[model samples]
Target: MPVTQSDIALAHHLADAAGAVIRGYFRQPAGLEIKEDRSPVTLADREAEAAMRRLIEAERSGDGIVGEEYGTKDGVTNRRWVLDPIDGTHSFTAGRAIFGTLIALVEDGWPVLGVIDQPVQRERWIGVAGRPTTFNGTPVRTRACPQLEGAVMATTSPHYFGEDAALRYLALTAATSGGHNRMTPIYGGDCYNYGLLASGQIDLVCESGLKLHDFAALVPVAEGAGGRMCDWNGDPLTTDSDGHVLAIGDPARVDDVLEALHRVHD
Candidate 1:
């Protein structure tokens, strides 16, 4: 189904509101607390999520919501909004610009609308399933880098991998001739990187430690851009997986990286 302009407008408004909530707390002296998951949580994160939740509830009354800060609200609507109000709480607390907001509208478990808003970068990427992806209102497409040797990859954090896993990842990088591996600690940037993948700016993105809110929106954005997103084993990502994601510009490159990852694991 084609996405409506109303959906886009609602997503944009939601992102803008969330960004304002996050920016209001930026650079202000505030206390940080740890959640039970050991992830850092700040007032900005909770407030932003709350603001987004409120806007979504008001605008899309029949739609369901799954948010990072708040738990799920079971509804009968086939359309649900998956939100990560502050994608990079760690980076935000550290005064970094890699954090952003992730929002996706899923219809019947398939993402029909995806939006990634990078407030610090002042950029937004939107994708509608079976439609062209866009960056700031302009259409975007992924590059044609099918070989691992020519692909550049990015990840949220290197410390996410233990010593053995890190070594294996490094080996995969080496096999790819070490093409511009960046470790940007941006939790929400995963979706942003998928936008870049669609725009041909980045070739690959691999990361773990994610949730359904983290990967669901990215699936359509990446695939809609002529790219592919999957788990490390080259399997479809589900809400119940281990939260590891591997996205690449070309299918061949994705396969190559997955093979290397499998070899390392072996």
Candidate 2:
């Protein structure tokens, strides 16, 4: 189904609501705690998602919602919203400005629109299905990286990769670097890297253990900007993905990265 202009406007409105809550706690000391998964969660994340939820419930009462801080809210319609109020919570809690609010709309279980809003940086990227991606209302495109040797790669962190996956990721980056010694992949950008890739700043992003909310907003943004984002096996990302994700500015380079990732033992 096609996304209506009203839907796009509501997506931005959701981002604005999330951003307002996030910006209030941007640099101030936040009340933080560790979830059972050992990941950090702060008041900013909780309040921001709540803010978006309030607006969503008020405006689109029939739409479902899935958020990082709060659990699922079943809806009466097929349209659903995925929210990650603070994608880079570690950075956010550390007083870094790399964190952003992620908003994505899934229609019939498929993402049709996405927004990445960096409140501190005042940068926003909006992508809708069958439409050109926009950065602050201006159309944006990805830079070309016909090959891997010169491509800039980014990942949130290797710590999330576990031992076996980390080795494979290193091998893949080695291939991109032309050898094991030539490349140093950038680290710690979180969802910001995907927004950058959509805007053509980064070339490739490979990460493991992403949830629906983690990479959901990135799909439309990447594809809308002339890039491809998929699983490690080149499968389209969805709610059922295995959490291993690959986003490349150049579609031609995917096979090479996948091959390198498989060269190592699992």
Candidate 3:
């Protein structure tokens, strides 16, 4: 079934709830701890997700849940609410404003509604399938780029890519590093990159090792803004996607970006 107006309102409510919990802990000794993967987590991350989950259960008891801090919760319907309470816990604990809350509603393994909420910045991006993306209630569109060359691109970090994948990422940097702009990849983006792309701030974002909760919301947000989101190999993002993701503001630049991503290097 399609997402309803009620679904959209609930999504905003979820963001609001998570944002409130996150604000309480932001930069105030958030009780940070290291997870098994060597990544940091904080009191805000756990509490924010818990807050959203509660709201979801209260409003839509039939919907499933996929979360970062907590694990999955199965439901009776095909719809699932995916949550990443804080996209950049490391940055959040450091008092940086780049981190944001990510929420996506996946129906039948495909995302139909997405919300990227930055409570600290008071910026909210909403994207629903078959609708234009909006930033703080105003519709937004992706900016056009002539080609991949010199296009500004971003990723959270290089470490997300493995040994072999790092080389492929390097190839993309080299491809877009030419021309007068002579640009390299911006080092930190996380969920903010896709929002910026939707609002016409950047041209591309490519990364690997993402989870369903990581890239699920991004697809609708980017695609609704006249962009395209897919795997590095140009496949559509599904629950079954391999975690390699590429977001291009200009659909025309996709072939060039994919070619660069696959371009072999010595």
If scored against the real structure, what TM-score would every candidate get?
A: 0.88, 0.97, 0.97
lDDT of 2 by residue, 1-266 (tens): 68999999998888888788888888897899999988899998999899899999999999999998898999999988999999999999988888788999998777889999999888999999889999999999889887888679999999899888899998888878887565788999898998899988999999999999998899999999999988988898888889999999888888888888988974
Off by over 4 Å in 2: 180-182
Residue pairs whose backbone atoms clash in candidate 2: none
User: Candidate 1 on 142-194: residue-level lDDT in tens?
Assistant: 88885787467787778787776677677677666654545322233546677
Mark the regions of model 3 whose C-alpha exceeds 4 Å error after superposition: 179-182
* Residue 174 Cα positional deviation in candidate 2, in Å, after optimal superposition: 0.5
Backbone clashes in candidate 3 total: 0
Residue runs of model 1 more than 4 Å from their true location after superposition: 162-168, 178-191
Residue clash pairs of candidate 3: none
Best-to-worst TM-score order: 3, 2, 1
